[model samples]
Target chain A: MDDDGRDRPPVPTGRSERARTAALEAALALAVELPYPQVTMEAIAARAGVGKATLYRRWRHRGALLVDAVAHRNARAAVGDGRIPDTGDLQADLSAVLRAVVDELAVPAWDALLRALCVEALVDTAVGAQVLEEVFAPQITLFARRFAAARATGHIDGSVGDVEAFELFVAPLFHRWQLRTGALDHAYADAVVRRGCRALSP
Target chain B: MDDDGRDRPPVPTGRSERARTAALEAALALAVELPYPQVTMEAIAARAGVGKATLYRRWRHRGALLVDAVAHRNARAAVGDGRIPDTGDLQADLSAVLRAVVDELAVPAWDALLRALCVEALVDTAVGAQVLEEVFAPQITLFARRFAAARATGHIDGSVGDVEAFELFVAPLFHRWQLRTGALDHAYADAVVRRGCRALSP
Candidate 1:
């Protein structure tokens, strides 16, 4: 059984899977176009070229549909490669990842979708927890692993735990993005990594 | 000539000033009691023991009322005492302020209200910008000033600029608080300041 709670189907994919994907894509597109409250089941079904009954059969309500749509969209970018790029220099690899995040936030659609999802999550606790777990937690774990690896290699100070070090590096990026205080750029990433590395120096 | 833009009736002391303070307090109290959507002019007025007409006389609507409430609630605590406590040690001062922030977050009503305001701000750009300016910007400026003072006193590396250093030190705290990832505690604060100070070392 896969993590999503169903066994992997054999090859020769059927129309049902295609329809499900289409429905999610349509829901995501609609979420971007309209506010969370306005993204109705009927609209999603119509956009997906499926019937309202079909959408209802799968999702109990608009919030559930939005949740599934966001989850599906986030799964595509789920961070998996566990290696922390121990090229004898921890700072360089960390800088590379932080810079990538800055670039990712520059994409308008990603920022819009994230902001919308955050707003919805604020109102709905369950949805917020699910997003933190499925969408945000995975990325955090990846960074934690890297930090742990750096600690093992003595590239980082032994006293600094994985979680603390990870927060030190990534928290700043999210803070800047969420608050819109300043630009998240390569220069900022470099400063964070350099400062973080120095802090961890034994 | 009060900060709220309301004409003062020159009350040397007594009921009118108290009434104004009570109205703002009621607005803040109502935000925690009900979500921003459920809060209304009538509810705030009733909570404040003032008439709806009185609330309208002061604030045009619920948005204005809530904005003023948030502004009043956070004003004093957010701004440092125009000094960064330069005890000839950069790390200690930074850690002290960061720890205070952790204590601030532990106040249950504060976090919930901040989340609500942030969510509303996303949807309403004007309110969002105003909150950032009136609330968050001043705090960031204070940290920047501290960094400048630290640099001038030779405690920190003069090479690091004020804004960059400020982001390095403060972003992580806001990031952790806003995301609800981990505990914002003294240990984490100390680590952040220690690491940041080291990185900024000339």
Candidate 2:
């Protein structure tokens, strides 16, 4: 719903598309330049040269807008597609996907932006919910699908539930990255895949 | 080191010890009551009824003081002893330890305080380093030690390194809790232990 609650779509025009693009771009840039909490709607409007009303019409609040902004960035970067390659080799496929994650996180700008979003999500429950829904769920669901297919094909043990399988494959990287406890590299990612397979494969 | 670069211990009188206790308690309370970045030294001093000079004399900055406050709370609660019960049943012991973590995180004040500390650690590299050293390293090291012992006893596969072993046993819970991705309960904790032991045990 837009700010006015009319539930109308974004004005579909070349100009409207440009403004939306500019607004999301500005939100991403400002999020990186300032602390996430301090990146206000007004600043995003000014940076994007869009009226506050227009920005609000598109997004309900800062959280909503920033969600779109980060999602936009991720889409542009071709990350979080939620589809693992299925060459009938589960470990090799998982390793490739996790290595891609390592590569994405290694980029400094991407790291800072994600860390900022993570800080915001940690503090605010509503934002956290939105992030879980829009950002993480798609990827999680797709990964679960891949796991189910693997189980059906006898690539993994059928006893492991989807949730456990997903956590087993991915949680180690998320844990290490969040805590800054160790290096997040291809080797660690491959180790996770190897361990996960040993635990799950038939 | 103290703020003045003098390496003196806190005054060892009974009165000084009481003051120190009051300060740490105040820091913990204020950290829960306020946003972490806004919880300043002066504010902690005022809340504790200790002079600001005395607070600084014992600790270098807000991060250092807050770390002590959190560690004190954990110690009083007996949370992070870094010792897992060696009942020769690795899965049961891991389940017991992880369930304790889940219980600790279930407390509202403890959750809020640790989340606040996590936010600060995420934003500041110096604070991050200190947190890793004082708050997380001990737990990780002790867990690693337990894994090594388990390996030597032939409880777990010897091929898994300490790093992979530790991550396998602990990282899933940390991942779920940090992301608020699912229910953090005894059942989930037990599931993680089951999966981990299956992955690691000979």
Candidate 3:
């Protein structure tokens, strides 16, 4: 869970939050521009214009830095990103939500952080669980609520449960993202929503 | 692409193939039994019952070893496992194919190799490309052919391409697998197939 701690450094405090954010933003930007292996503490410090000691005191190495960068971004995104637009039309609402996600994902910062986080999750169960709870669990819960509302309104049918409906709504986009199989666009989002409505409706 | 090769050794040859195979199998077995960091070269050699040099002469470190192990296993599984039973019923045939995949994925060796390869792919694009072509591409191709047949029989619509059909068929299982959000069993397989059939049918 600790990932050997040779990499994890001290926890960021209120005093260090701004400094840490700056450093992580620099780290994520650099990571997007270069390969993960090449994004080093010294380079991040240089880019952030923070003292090398500032980074070293908080992060022992690259892994901890990247993990926390993604974690931090995810936490911030979750604050306002969770609100799905409600049009009462389940298809439009779901497509709108998915397209919003594509927009969020298209950001260079989020893109790099997500790619790095997915890699870390694959290597470390602690990170994986962290993402599941902090990122996916909340989204899934919201989607479930939406689906239930839709079902009550005669949008989605009773054939599919909330869990299955949520999976149907979101899993395809995630699958494409992880596998690098295709593009995530408005057209793709609409297609998924259309297919999902057909499958989930009676 | 090379992943810094500080740990990469020479390529294994004809004489070393046997040695390499044994060591990789042992490595994969131990990987399944333990964490990635703990699955060391010394431990693999000990478990494999080969000289340490036999391992070092071929693989420089753990990543290289695990990647090769997964690549080898994927190559072998692709030969026979890609054949989906054609029952002439679209829903039944897809369920059978997905169930077969669930069975293959359930194996300890395959599970471990897959987890290892996914992590390696995150760190190395060369390994990622190799997996795409060697592992995913073949299966996707076969699924495309099957979907085409289903289409010819008026099962699936011309609205969705073979690629979209394949994605709809398989992405849910992968999403569940990667996220550990649900069980991958006969019921799960059937649910996914049922949803897919409804979504894609003419």
Candidate 4:
């Protein structure tokens, strides 16, 4: 949350906060409706009933606006501060977390939005970096925290790094989803969990 | 390679073969130079020194053209029939394969072209499916073949399906590359091989 005063606008007052929310909501709506490249700043401004100057003042480019918009939505949609539950059993927790992930991916609107974000990320590395920082990094950190707890309980090997270890479970789901290689169902999630548990064992 | 006669143009012969090569080469060249959405069919035709009619005769759309172009480049770039080498030592072979994969991903031009293909694949599900079937599926099959050999030699567990098991090693690499999560080096690749071997043990 280091504010260099470039990427983010000044802290908004109550009235401007509402306007900011409206602008972000409009951006997200247009994002899911149109391809990311086609979703222009002008369109978002018009959709939000704001002037072009107002939009530009807050966001430098369409990619920046879209990243913030998606980040906002992700934050709102997360369940209870977005921490993966550690129920003392790492396998069950991983299965439950991955199951929820697959379920979210099954929703068309959410999938489309995520696809758009992914396209934007690929198209612009700066956007990609922002997304990693604002979205995926926090989630990865939560997983790391959960892994630490699991390690304390002697559930996983102490030698394997949590970040790398977590990818054994999560990355396959992401890779499958990105490529449209197969169905993203509970079965696939469970299989990943099983493999992950086996891999992390001492 | 079932030809429904719709997805592919008539097999080129004699002089038309040159034109087909020219078009595909141009598509690949332009794909690396420009963002995928901006690489128009007209531009490709112009660059190839071929008429629009010649281009259209082969490919119905830009996506189709790009897919073939990328697939062609991939086939040619692949070393020795594109199979994961089965030297009877599964760990060393996987390490070698993954090491080569990371090397390929590091090449700037190749990375750009693959990024373009990935963007196109995300934008169009049809393109996505074609990329999987024509490109990734063959490679997956190769991995499956290697895993089958490994299983026979007792290198891995028999209970896990080869297709699903292969993801433990490959998907993490793909995910890391796509997300730019970390440095994809020999070190990362070797780490994955270690985790993969541990995960796949009987």
Which one is best on lDDT? 4
Chain A TM-score, prediction 1: 0.76
**Cα RMSDs of all predictions?**
4.3, 4.3, 7.0, 3.4
lDDT for residue A42 in candidate 1, whole number 0-100: 86
lDDT of 1 by residue, B1-202 (tens): 1365432222326676666777878888887777667778888778889888877886666766676677666553443435567677778888888888788778777777777777767767776766667666656667777778877877778887666687777877776676666768888788778878877887
Compute the lDDT for candidate 1: 0.72
Q: Per-residue alpha-carbon lDDT of model 2 for A1-202, expressed as tens digits?
A: 1253112223436887878888989998887788666789999999999999999998888877877777666545544533678888889998998999899889787787788777777888777776776667656776887898898898898877776788897899987887777889999999899889988868
Candidate 3 local lDDT, A1-202, one digit each (tens): 2353221333556667668878978987887787666788888999988999999898766666776666555445643345565678889988888887788778765666677777777766666666666557656767877877877888777777766787886888887766666788888889999998999886
Inter-residue clash pairs, candidate 4: none
Shift in Å, residue B52, candidate 4: 2.1
Two-chain DockQ for each candidate model: 0.54, 0.61, 0.46, 0.73
**For candidate 4, what is the DockQ-based docking class?**
medium
| Model 1 ranges with Cα > 4 A deviation | A1-20, A32-38, A50-68, A78-89, B1-22, B49-61, B78-84
Best by DockQ: 4
lDDT of 1 by residue, A1-202 (tens): 1285321221226787777788888988886787656678888899999999888887776766665666666455423334446576788988888887788778776677677777767767776766666556766667777777777887778877666777778877777777776778999888888888887887
Which regions of candidate 3 fall more than 4 Å away from where they truly are? A1-82, B1-75, B78-82
- By DockQ, the better pick of 2 and 4 is 4
Clashing pairs in 2: none
Q: lDDT tens digits, residues B110-202, model 3?
A: 665677777776666666665565456666777877877887888888789766777887888887877777788989999999999999878
Better of 3 and 4 by lDDT: 4
Report i-RMS for every model: 2.0, 1.3, 1.4, 1.0
The residue pairs in collision within model 3 are none
